[model samples]
Target chain A: MAMLFSDPFESLFNLQKALDAFHASGWLEPGPSAGGTYPPLNVFRKDDDAVVIIELPGVKKTDVDIQAKGSTIRISGTRTIEFPQKAGIHRRERIAGRFDRAITIPFEVNVEEVKAEYRDGILALFLPRAEQDKPRSIKLP
Target chain B: MVAPQELAVQPKKELTPKEEKTVPARYYVPNTDIHETDEALTLVMEMPGVEKKNIDVKLENDVLRIEGRIDFSKYEGLDPVYAEYNVGHFSRTFALSNKIDQDRIQADLQDGILTLTLPKAKQALPRQIPIN
Candidate 1:
């Protein structure tokens, strides 16, 4: 099946970057409130199936919890990073702690058939459209 | 005990390579944290979706370079519908001091995070002096 949907937010980021380049300083920098959502996601759809990918470095599978209901999916987890007691922090930029995010799709999700895979700190969920939500063709006499 | 709160994912920053590259590919610098102890200096980098075999660590002229390649074949037949971040190879470099013993440096990769330990030279370490 050919891929039908593409990330709608991709254009927004491109536009923001272009504006930033023009002004050298982003007057519209959404700051930490907007655009900076935890556990960044990428969604791809092929026919009636959609795959959601999340990047979570140094996270354990046991820490994350995923749930799907109707047209929404929720992911919640904690990220912990530990160092020796005597170690001194030189420069810290990476983030840690807990994160919870919810995403809603256009069609009802087949929660029972959804498949999840975690590898190399990346979690991907394969969601199929619900059977009842699929379009049906009617025959005329 | 305090409860943990939600974290914001920082926007990915792009790093432009200074020198001309043989391959015209975009490279994003991975997020890193540096920690130092009496014995060694540790560097932790976030490089998701990259296998251990695809990473390269190099040292030349007291400069340490790190690079990780991502396999694009994973997205061959897929079309993106929503993307919050761009996928690309990771690249970054650090200038090391003589106090670091490059020969004793160690590297480890786990769960898409790369850790590098650079041990201090024996002579550079502080020593306890006895009373005369």
Candidate 2:
């Protein structure tokens, strides 16, 4: 899951998105706070489970740690980006940071059955709905 | 097929002579086609090699900015054996008009495509009137 950006226009686009990220997290930065890299996340709710995904390019499976509670989940990871040694670097855009994101879910969830998987820089989390949290189908008498 | 122990990730390589320049060149400035209707304005952006996580859409200083980053480097102590596409981040800004309702803008990213739906300001939206 290696991620390196070499485009010239990337800075301009990141500036726009960073503004929105600041509004959501109350801080413009994510990571270890010491050169932390904050990747974006997408959250959605299904009928039986809640799915949360975080983009973590170049991060290895062993590099991430996740914790889940009744209605919240925490993800922590790191991306150490390296560059070519003999390339004679003129511009650098790779980010190195520790990332910790804590999300409070909208509904009660089953924490014991939560699972996470990472592939090709995408982390997928599946948290099943708690027994009482799931909607029931009833037949009228 | 490669085994688990011998998994060989792509290696980082030195840039070609073309890549050794000051600022990378782009074929064109990524732009959006904005079409306004009675209710919403549809914006389609030209963004390739961008993912949902790398993309950002926001309004600041009366400008609509679109941002994205791409990660494609493979490994250390190795050099790329082949190459095709170049990876880079993208940024583009558009001037927001009085006709737009900034607060209600909705964006969706799918398969590297970013579609933003911005509903018009009520006063700026078109209305129908009947002449009796």
Candidate 3:
């Protein structure tokens, strides 16, 4: 089971610092200037596979694009909002626009075995480790 | 109208032992958008990983509350190497005013996005009266 930590604000602060570093290093292209920040993601390793989950609410499955090469994966999508012409805007907090994010895994992955599933606005990816990258245990003499 | 002195006051309900002992769980506030039209108000919220069965919405005493629980127990026993987004509960509250018709409010959830429509009360709607 996933455990909820007591200090989310601190975690978010650290994430912001990491994002800033990524931007300064040119590792990730700055997100769209008009909309909000990039979507939050979780990456974890399950044995010999790397699992990635991204939150993309209000985005259609058809609009999302995923690509993987070597040890890196890229995700790009757009979210659109449509309201009636006569509707009056009250409060607008959710941002809608195009966003792109690329993440690098710690180990080389098998591109052919990559699997992706989108459900409930979450995009989950399973990337299997390359044959040569899997951990091997040696017997002691 | 009955006089205030003649009305009987109801006793306040007591909290059960289980309710008193229960600790409140921490909740993450989901991103939301609010729009208003001539006839109604619309609210859209983002709550990923929440399904229909795990979502709860309650309206009482002019306060609207929404809660969503995401269960990740299915992945138990799997090793975790890196984690960024934490899986947990999502919750938010909204106070409704007299201008809204509480009984006619409607809500729908799709693709992890929740949309709520609060219709304006008849008396609160704008009207154009013709000059006699």
**Of the candidates shown, which would achieve the greatest DockQ relative to the real structure?**
1
Rank by lDDT, descending? Answer: 1, 3, 2
Q: Per-residue lDDT for A25-139 in model 1, tens only?
A: 2211222223226787777666768888888988888989888887778788899888879999987988888987777777788999988999888999999999999889898
Q: For residue A130, what is the lDDT in candidate 3?
A: 97
Order candidates by DockQ, high to low.
1, 3, 2
lDDT of 3 by residue, A54-121 (tens): 77878889989998988778787777767778887777766666776767776788999999999888
Candidate 2 local lDDT, A1-141, one digit each (tens): 122245434533332233223334421122232322244554434445666655555566787889888777777776554443332233233344567666666668788889897664567688788899877899899
What order do you get sorting by TM-score, best first? 1, 3, 2
Candidate 1 residue runs with Cα over 4 Å from true position: A1-36, A136-141
lDDT of 2 at B97: 64
Error of 2 at B105 (Å): 42
For all the models shown, what interface RMSD does each have? 8.0, 19.9, 15.6
Chain B TM-score (each prediction, in order): 0.90, 0.62, 0.73
lDDT of 1 at A118: 91
Return the DockQ of model 2: 0.02
DockQ of prediction 1: 0.49
Tell me how much of the true interface, by contacts, candidate 2 captures: 0.00
Docking quality (DockQ) for each candidate: 0.49, 0.02, 0.20
Q: Is candidate 1 or candidate 2 better by lDDT?
A: 1
Cα misplacement distance, residue A79 of candidate 3 (Å): 1.5
Pairs of residues clashing in candidate 1: A6-B80, A6-B81, A7-B81, A7-B82
